[model samples]
Structure formats: C-alpha cells, structure tokens
Target: MPALITEAHDSTRLALSSHNPGAIEDFGLIGHKVAALADLAQNYTNSAIDSSELNRLITEHFPWWNDSTLRYFPWMRWPFKVMKDPSTYLKMLRHKVGIVIPAGDGNARETAHLITTLRNVHKCKLPIDIAYVGDGDMSPSIRAFLSRLGTNVNFIDLTQVFDNTLIQLKGYSSKPFAILASRYPRTILLDSDAVFFANPDDIFSMYQSLKETGLLFFHDRTVENGNTPVRQEWVGAQLKLAGRLPSAHLANNSLFFRHHIDEEADAALVAVDKSKPDTYMAMVFACWMNTKHVRETVTYQRLFGDKDTYWLAAELTGVPYAFEPWSSARLAQEPLIDKGFPLVAPVENNLARGPAAQVLEGASKPVSQASPTIAAEVLSDEKEAKSIKLLATDTSSSYDKNQTTSRVEAPHSTNELNFPRSSHNREFHDSPKPITPNRRCTTHMVHPHPDGSEPLWANGGLWLDKRDRGLGLANWTHWYVGSRNDEALKTFCETSLPTDSPNSKSWLTSEDGEQWHNEVMNTQPRWYSNDWGMDAEGCPQFEEWRWQSLNQGFRDRLERMIEEVRKVEAAWVLELG
Candidate 1:
C-alpha cells in the first residue's frame, strides 16, 4: 500500500505533496508549479478542449503539447505578488470584506459595480473595509468610484497575495487562503457580482459560539446543477479516507470565515490544488475542514436561495444554523431589486439532530414509521400480495408458520411519511441485517430477481455489498429517508459485509430499477465505480460514485413521483410553519 498521506501545514504548499514529489521546492515551489500547470491545463482545456482548437491541435501538429509536458514546465513567477504578512493586513481596524473579480483585461468593473452600488444606492450602514483581490491597478473609473466613498471605504490592493499562475485559473483560488491568512480576525468573502441590500455587519455577531470553528457560507439555491466533474473522484476518495460526509450543497457566491491557527486554513488552499473546475470551492473547503476538524462549528442560514445555501452547508459540515433575515443576491442573475431583497438576521442555531433533520425543511414530514423491530418478509398469495412479505427467516423455529409481520407503508410523498412515535426508534437503522436469499425479493413489475425469481420489493432499497450472498437485500432501512440515499449504499455495505468480501453473485439487481436481475444490476456497478473493493472498516473507497449513481436512479423515479404527488397535495402546505 502507498504511504499514508496527510494534509500540509505550510500555507504555500499543496494539500497532498506526494502527487507531485518532484515539484516540492524549498517551501511550496512544486505546489506552485503544479498550480501553474493546472492553470495552463485549465486554459487549454477551456479554450482548445471546448472548441475547434482541440480538433485543430489533435489533427495537426500542436507544438504546445510537444514543447513540454505540464509536469516539467519552467514555472513562471507571479507578478504583483503580495506576501501574506498578517501585520500589514492586521493594520485594519476590524474585519476585511474581501471580493475577488477575475476578468481577462484586469477590468475592475464588477468590483466598481458592487462597491458603487453599496455606497450610492443601498447606502449600506456597515462601515465597509474592502479588500479587492485581483490583478493590476484599478482603472481610473474604479479609483474615481472609490474616491466618492472616501474614508467610508478603505480599499486595500491584495492582488499580490495570489500566485501569478492563478491569474489564468478562472476560478476561486487563494481566496480562502487570503481570507484565512489575512491580518483581520474575521472575513466575509464575496463574489465580484454581489450587491448588498442591507448592512451585513451583524453577520459576524449572529453566532458567536460558532464564530471560532465554523466558517459561514451562503448555500447556492440550485444544487442540482451538479458540481464540476474534474477531481470529483479524487476528492470523493479523500473524503472517504478521512471519514467525512460529501457536502450536500454547493456554496459559490458568499462565504464567512475567521482566520484560524491550524492546518485547516492551509488545507483549504490545498483542496483547491487537488480539485479542478473551481466552481464548488466552498464544498471542497467544507469537506477538507470537516475532515481536519479545522472548524469545530459549521452554521448555515437561508441566506442564499430559500433554504438552498443553508442545507447545502449543513450537509457538508454536519453543522446547523437557524434561518435568519439578512438576505443578499447576485444582481447579475437575479434582477430582483423591484421585489425587495430577502431578509437576514441572527436566528437561533439548531444543531441538526441527524442527516434527516437537515433535509426535512419546509417539506412537512411526519415521523418515520419504518422500524427494524418488525422484520420484513415476502409472501406471494396467488390471489393477493401486499408488497411486504411474511416469509419466515432461516433462523425461525417454524418455517411453516409465516408470522403476520407489521410493516411500514411507503408514503405517497416524502411529506406524508409517518415516523415512529418513539424518539429512540431511529428513522433508519445505521446497521441493518443482511437480507437472506429467500427474503431478497421485489414487487415492482419492472424489476425481477436476477435468479429470475419474482420481484417483490418496491421501496428503492440499496444493494448491500454487491456481493453474491445470493445478491440478497442488505439494508432496506433507508427506503424512506431522502437524505440517506447518497451515503446509504456504502454505509449499509460497510456494516453488513466484510471489507475484503468479493461479490460472488454474477446475477445481481439493477440500481436503476428497470430490471431486477444481473441483466441490469451486473451492468451498473454503482454509477462511477470502476471495480468493487473495500477498506478495513468495510467502507468502499469510491462510494461516492456508487452513491451518486444509485441516488440518481432513485431520484429519477422518486422526483417525478414527488412532483405528481405535490401537485395533488399542494394545499397541504398551509398546515406548515
């Protein structure tokens, strides 16, 4: 096995130096070089890969590729570099409101637009000390715009703190590093397109308890847009190794964090290096911070889209925050100035009881009635068969006597789920018993058993370990919980089977639910997984791929079913808070 890798402590170094051992310099020379190469790759990939240039280069001789491989380029030094000297940054009276605008011509139009709007139209009450992080001197227009704000706005040029290689990266790079390493104890990083609707000075005081360990980030309202495809597999593998949860939501526009004296700050920067398509930097940082225990608290609020940002941050950090009133939007996309801005204020912080609680917002949900106490069975009555079976287990003393087992009914919609009354009755059992071959059955007409047995189950259960064990149902406990879908497959597999267990059954069921047997299941080995393997703890290394794949299948059926059900039950929301 390869040596156990760990995060870096140096601010200048990459998160995982082992990936580019030759690039390791006196400080972070190698990491910087790799970042430069990544910048180069990003440019090439964006330009050539996205257009005719790729075909042109591929069909003809492209000297760029032949000139030097990415790994060995004579690295260029960053121009207008600003060293991270906390003393210089510390000179500020209070927090620094940092904004990064990446444009080709070094135009600060976005910066100018945001600040000018905040100063002129909104007339923000908060005394804004802006840290403009970008390249080149501000254009005359930007300078003139700042001059209007005068002493009210102390503009600091932080274009130097970021590496020169990152100038072309076209994403959030070194922003976290700049924020975390800044002289200010706290920082609120905003995108260039942000327009403040109100004074956000109180955000820092909202959750004083979490102000130390947890970084505050606004969750993007739309998480379904998906994440950048690059480094997803690699980051997923790292999170699994670290035993951290995949961020439920992606944070893009707004982030709040305090400078800390730990490896987590540096680690966030490294995560940037390790991953590509920097759109989801907040998520990547959340995962890294959670793994490193960098932040002890993670507080999310409905500051972004309805509750999108709040839930997404909650998903990644496993932390929770109450709904607040201070709401801002990217005017670039949402021209909602006519409708009045969303509100944001300090609300009570509520620790998520568990994963389910995080996702059960606004959507009225009853108690999860699914319990492990009543074992499930399959009974095929020639005339009638209620999806839940009553077959006897092998351990049962009397196989002839099929007990009338109490079973939970699948809700027509997620909101209608009737949970068990007892608090001790966990919504879904973390460790479910493995399904015996005889018990592994489905009811859906579309999904038949791989052995050609009758399909009896309907509630979208996960494939346990993907091992033969008759390819039996492993953990059906999570059929009701929406939050469990992504992590359920691996969690169930890790609990029910041995780490080294190889799938013995060639005839397995499909995750997509189109077919039950090997015809479909054999073809789809969890979505992105290339092979089946496990660590000592029984957790699959590439569980993200499988989880994503399996959940997508469930969502395909569940989402449509949900929409139809919601259309019918739309009036029921009047009862909710």
Candidate 2:
C-alpha cells in the first residue's frame, strides 16, 4: 500500500528523458514509495545475496538499486535514464482503473461510435482519456464536438505531455503515450474501432489474471514462420546481451525468441498497471521503441508496427506480465445467418441454424468443454503446411468469391467440438487437399472472455468489412483460435500473488521461486530459439485452428451494440457542421 509514482520523475527533471521539463515538481507524490524502497534496500544489505535476488530487487524498487551489485542480467545494461513518465502525475495513488483511447482526425467517427457504445450499451462508468498527438490531429472543432458528445471523457495531447523533440506521434506509437499518460493506476487502453460485448468496467473484476499481474496483453493469430530472422536476432541479441533470465512468459509469448510460436501482440485492447515499478519500466521501454530513432531504425521494420513492443519490453525488463491463455480469433465476413460464415469458421459449439445447417449437412459436432484455451482441442486433424501463400485480393472479392460457386468439405476437428455447427469450415483452412484456403484471411483480431462466456472485444471496427464498407454492419461471432501449450503454462499462468507480501516479487527470488523457475523452464515443451521471433513480414500464412461460437444471447447483444453505434455515428459531425 505504498503511495508511489513509479514514473521517472528524476530523469525528466534532468532534461535527458523524452518527457517535458519540470514534469512533477511535487516531491510529495513519490514520498511513501521512496521511503518504502529506502527501507527495503537498507534492511537487505547482506553482502552474499545471489544474482537472482539482485535482479529481483532491482525490478522491485528500480533506481534505488546500486549498479555496482551486478550478479546477472545487469539492470544498468538497460538503464532507466531521465525518461519523462508521461508528463502527467497523479497526486494520490491507489488501486483504481480507467480507460485510455487514441483518437483524432483519422478515426474521429469510430471514436465517437466507441465512446457512445461504452457509455450507452455496455454502460461502463470508467473515466476515459481521449489522447491525440496534438491539436492538429485533434482539431479544436472535433474536440468540442466530442466533449459535447461523450460523458466522463478527458483529452490529452501527446505533444504537450511527452517531449516530441525525438518522437513523432505516428498512430502506432500513440498507444504507449496514451497508456502512460493516463491518470489512473490501472489503464484499459483501446483502439477507437474496438467493439466489446462485455462491459469494460467488469475487466478489473472478471479475470483472475488481471488481479494477479496488473498487465494482460492479448495475442495475434497463430501463423507459421511468425518468428522471423531480423526480429529474432534483434530480440535474441538484446536478451543475450543483457544476460536475461528465463521466465514463463517468454516461453509462452508469440515470439518465443526462437520462432516456435506466433509473432504479434494485438494492441486494440490492452490492460496495464503503471503503478507497479516493473510495469512502469516496461512501458518506458515500449515507448522508446516507438520513438523516432528506435522505431525507424528497427522496431517498425523488424516487427509489425507497435503491436509486439508491449510484451517485448516486459520480457526485456524481466517483469511479470500475462497474455490471455486463449488464442486470437476473428469474425466471419457475414453473421451466422448465412452458410458462408459457419462453413468456414471454427466449428461453432451451438445448435446449427437454417441456411447454416444446409452446408454442415447434419454432421453434428460434439459439445466442446468450457475451457478458455480451446485452440488445440478443436484444430483440424490435418497436419497443415508450415507455409501458405496470401493473395493480394481485396476483402470484397475474397468473401464474395469464396461464398458463391464453392461448396467445401468441413475440416475435421480434433475433439468433440460441436456446440451448434454441423461441421468445421472449408474456406481459409487446410485438410481438403487440392483446395487451399486463405490462411492469411484473418483481419479483425479477436479475444474472448477467458471463460468463453462472451466476447470481450474485437479490433478493426464493427463494419462487416473494413476494406469494403458497403457490405454493411458486421456481426462477427465465430472465432478460429489457438493457445499456448497448457502443460508448459501451468507453472506461471495466472499464478496467485504471493500471500506473504503485497506483491509477488518478494518470494520470487527466494529458494522456492528459484527452484520453480528452473524446473518449469527445463520441463516446458519446446526449449530452443532456433527460429527468430519473425522476419520483415512474419508469416506468409498460418494453418492449425479451432472454432468457438458465441451463443444466441451474445449474438443478440452484438446486434444491439452495432445498432447503437450506428445511431451515434449517424448524429456525428464530420466537419464541424
């Protein structure tokens, strides 16, 4: 219960960090945190502490650690120099959560729609901070219009808060800025186009994962060759150079150093607690990755924009973070109302409907378990090719062409997967030889509530197709998903915070933690980094998949949300009219 502002106040004052000058003159803000850290460091002055203990404590208090005590993973290698911790500082620090969304000229319409949906449909009461680059991106007229439109909304200008001298506010980089700039201790960061079936206010309460780690990032779809050489080498080098220790998250990440897994992080919706020293440091590093020099040099070119930086920073900082156990999924071009959607989507676990049943043809699927990560259990029996080619065709052409004139045999599921669907999909899939489905057809990334009860949200807007807006409102319900190997994740995934201490860091470096870390890393399924996390373009296409369909109740809820957002947009002022 320390009232601490973990932001780099000392660094910003030095005029060395990218934050503005004299960011927080009030030393009172970090008073308790400083006192607590001092007591811990002074009390633990035993000369014989091991490298593991040293690294753990450094992450515990940061800046308070003595650089001379380097047993392993030298904190000095990635030092916390004068970084401006998002120019804004909170006077009182407590366990509170709020929302941060990046908005401006590019997505003003969607921003309006999102705000309306959050306030009206889900009825989320969380305060929202709408962060834009500057007045240029957030025109005064647009700001006025949004203020008049939204409730509990605050605006933050990145240029004004962080020192824009080094980094330009490109859309990709704005995520970290908005997140760090939030006044709340915990931040729910979202892209304007995000559509949620559940109330965001329920986020801090619904999942055990969020309570345990304060930082939960969702995954990108599982695609082959996701680990590329350039990204792999860079991250690998950084990890090695820093002499980083192995943690369970690294083994479970999309880019597991060696290209064994996928290669991305979906930023559409991210949850983080900046009050934690480890997480605060991770955000600073993530922000630096988006800065002009770093981003232009290797971040964007090697990785997929700013998507992967969040986890990578956490990994490098040696902080505890979580990516939901479930694999990423997406909506079909149409709703379950048609054969095209059900035929190609992961086999829905619900009873099939009229036209949708015509295609499945009564090959009823088994009822899938209520498990959160069903990607592996529901995957096709086919040993999909490691690589598939992507066509440059537009969304309009792909869905239309796949729907008409083509009737496909469903890919067999690995388990008793039928909840509703008569069978699995033929499009964007493998197993039915000669006909290659578009594995790269995944566009709108999806994440479900860990319990599989309802969709938490999906990125890329509510439009049926972002590429072809004319198709009308999208009712994306089904998902093709994957998850990390369960056996490997059991050790670190959603582990309860150690009861003895306020945070998990205390016992993490103790004898039991050290033993557990060693046992888990050695026993995990795959233990090689032969493949880099990714190449310039991570995957040509991906293959293995599972299907999870929301129930009719969710579908009904989705329709209501879509209709509500549309109404909000209908009243929106595009040009200050």
Tens-place lDDT per residue, model 2, 343-372, is 122223422222321222223211111121
Model 1, span 21-93: residue lDDT tens: 3311111222222232223333332111232332233213212121121211111111233224433432342
How much is 250 displaced in model 1, in angstroms?
10
TM agreement with the true structure for every prediction: 0.31, 0.60
Q: After superposition, how far is residue 96 of candidate 2 from its true place, in Å?
A: 1.6
Model 1 TM-score?
0.31
Off by over 4 Å in 2: 1-92, 225-227, 252-258, 333-442, 483-546, 573-577
Cα lDDT, all candidates: 0.25, 0.52
Model 1's lDDT to the true fold?
Answer: 0.25
**In the order shown, what is each candidate's alpha-carbon RMSD?**
24.1, 17.0
